[model samples]
Target: MATGDAKLILPFNSAFSSSYWMRWQTPVCFLITVSPGIAAALMLYRLKRRRGCDHLPAAATWAPCFRGVPPLVLPVYRGLVVISMISVLYCLLRLNGLVEFYFYTQWTFLLVIIYFLIGTIISAHGCWVYYRQRRRQGVEEGNRFLTFNRDDNVDNHTALVTADNNSGGKLEDKRAGTWGYCMQIIYQTCGGAVMLTDVVFWCILVPYMSSAHFSVNLVMGCMHSLNLLFLLVDTLLNSMPFPWFRMAYFILWSCTYVIFQWILHACGFSWWPYPFLELATPWAPLWYFCMALIHVPCYGAYWLIVKAKNTYFPRFFPHSYVSL
Candidate 1:
């Protein structure tokens, strides 16, 4: 019942666009979005059911294989997470309240926030483990030094090496656990979601809808920009491997949102958040198909960034950098 450029509309009880569901475009739009969702769902199911198919190395660790990376990286990264979360929350507050959460931008932003929160907890545990291992190694080395008997000292050193190997094996097993998989999937999903949200908002919505339905403000700008900014910084810092197969999860994420919109409209909710999503238009099929195809480049671009970092960093800073 909102008026003017409010982007709200009366439910089905109000006057209908007679052509809304009557056109051939409706089913075409449905197929464009939902078919990929179905295929992606099946792909994920098989991935989980099949052994050796999905290898989720722990993305939570500062450096998975190499301990030479400074332990301070964890604490500093946690500080960045806290700052990013606060800024996003402030922007949400400026947009009014929880009602703003209705938009997909907010959904993706919230996912990024959740990822950071989970990351903070995991990284804190890593910091404790790092310092504890350093202390244990120092104490053991000191005890070996006190034993001047060279043979006995050698035996003690061998025992320490064996124990370290056992602990490392356990850590590798932990990396394949369920929580590790969740973190990796969330990271990949956020990669695609943020890209799509920003691109559509700035390039399409801002140009076309700004004069009529869309309002561009500082808070809205930050919501779009900061989501990608924070995620990009995390990608640069974290040791996570971005396997391209996890793009299935990204497709599923967007599909769920599109299906949600369809369900709302079916239930007599009238508002279409973006005009291209409106099925009443004859171009709806074209828009939906284009949206579907755009996922590839959106995700591929982020993948390329990660690939470039891994390829170039080790060469440039051979002493300091470690590629995942």
Candidate 2:
């Protein structure tokens, strides 16, 4: 087939048949479209509003990161922000014409970096404030410091926190101040952003959308792997607590992007950064719906990873810093 003819083919089309749906009108596609929505909804339903961080699970194995950023995790988390910021700047300055600038992969990469930057800044500020407050009060010698969710939760939709008596009454349920709250918002929002960004890039864009001559460069490679890597490392070190319902923020984030794209197209730009986003095709709605549904799983899987790390690590390595 001619190159021009190939370009005209719908993204879902292949060599054997023109339409992928026609070739495989089976249960798999139906499950893929419907399952994520149901699952995400169920997870949201499970979150009950609590008066305080009383419901916040207090596992001896895992520390609550939502309050104050751990002093140790700072370096790795900031390192990711640095790497991502540099990678993005390099791409924008050096490879401007070689890449699709507005593509979701690029957008997500940028978003993750922004998230890290905001989070790191807030954590640093909060930590400084914490120390200054300590010095001002003339208190010293205790390892446990009072922080938000130290014992109480302020959010109306916050889930229950599990108690760990083994903590020897060390964890306090203090209110998260301005900086702490900012960091919490950014941290929770990032839970889904990281997964959604990485999954789409690795599973869809790079494999199917990248052009024939497009080869993975150092930055390209780092951009994909490092986002997830940084978050996982943060998971191991930070005291931020991630709950399942926070995926709602992630959904809203993606929806905002789609709306922005629509607005841009409405103004005059005709190009869609991704072929899956093109509405001219008959299966466009299906594509959109499936993409929406997939968010739940992608987000859920990452949550599970955090939960798994929190659950198993203490049992396996009781003396690790992860064990509060």
Candidate 3:
């Protein structure tokens, strides 16, 4: 079956010359492709009645990554950095920073690691502030932490005094927010990038590429799947908001990659990392167009996972869910 799949993708010409994909791949791919449209349409069904998709206030800022997360959530964020760092070290050691024209997956995987590392630092600092403020305020009671405040305004929420300036203004407006805004952008974006890059690599690229004699190593599999696994686990554990409008960031991330690839090709790199990225193919335009469309569903899938957690977990275990 693997070899047959490879033969089906013989070349750019195969897209026109063959009907094999129509037999099996078509139905599956079609369903994957259309589901996003269906989801978006359904979401917009009430668009007319409502002002628009209501967004979390924290999600609107560049900070707070949707604030008031439980301290336990810190470990989940840290775990991503730990796992991704290991994966990255493994890749870097093996590849030794070799040639550049390999795959966009590697680039995106590295980006995710950096994203998590930065977020981990920011979240850690936030957790520290969260605790220190409580201690200072003398709110030693356990209930102080239980009150979930997702607001971005820190004036009343946190008692942590910002570094004062000679002019009597709080210097730079410091608090748990110092890292929250930027971390929020990267965290939301990395979620989609990690999922899109891995899902496509494992489901679509691997079977086809491996059949074409591309070596499928254990490390490669780990690199792809581990990212999604870590993020999914974090999502299930964390109370952070995952707003759908953040799909804008995901799309921009991919476009920036495409632009980078183009710049590399302009300099000297002759090969396209992913086959679909090669523009000489007759179906290249379609490939690019489909990829642009794919981002919507890829992001929405994660969005739904977060949404389900928010909607159902509270009903099943209200007390436990609050702690999440």
What is the descending lDDT order? Answer: 1, 3, 2
Which parts of model 1 are misplaced by more than 4 Å?
1-19, 64-69, 139-174
The candidate 1 region of ten consecutive residues with least summed lDDT is 153-162
* Residues 151-234, model 3: lDDT tens digits: 545422322233234543232322225355555556678788877887787788877775545655556666677778776766
- The residue-by-residue lDDT of candidate 2 on 1-324, one tens digit each, is 011112222122123222332423323434544455466556555543434432332221123333334453564457566676766556543554433445565666666676667666655654564455456444541223433232434432222221335653343434455545545545666767768777776777767754663445556666677777876776766656676667766666676667676555545556566666666566776887778878878888878887888788667765543322
Per-residue alpha-carbon lDDT of model 1 for 1-324, expressed as tens digits? 011224333345333444456789988888999899989999888878988765543434444323345655755775686676668666555445565655788788888887777667776765665556556666554232112232442221111111265564121223435666677788899998899899988888777765544567666777788888888877777767787888999999999888888776776667777777888778889999999999999999899988988788777766655443
Number of the predicted model whose lDDT against the real structure is largest: 1
How well does candidate 2 score on lDDT at residue 228? 77
User: Residue-pair clashes per candidate, as listed?
Assistant: 0, 20, 5
Candidates 1 and 3 compared: the better one by TM-score is 1
Query: In order, what is each prediction's RMSD in angstroms?
Result: 6.9, 9.2, 9.2
The most accurate candidate by TM-score is 1
Query: Of models 2 and 3, which has the larger lDDT?
Result: 3
Which parts of model 2 are misplaced by more than 4 Å?
A: 1-80, 97-101, 126-140, 146-172, 213-215, 321-324
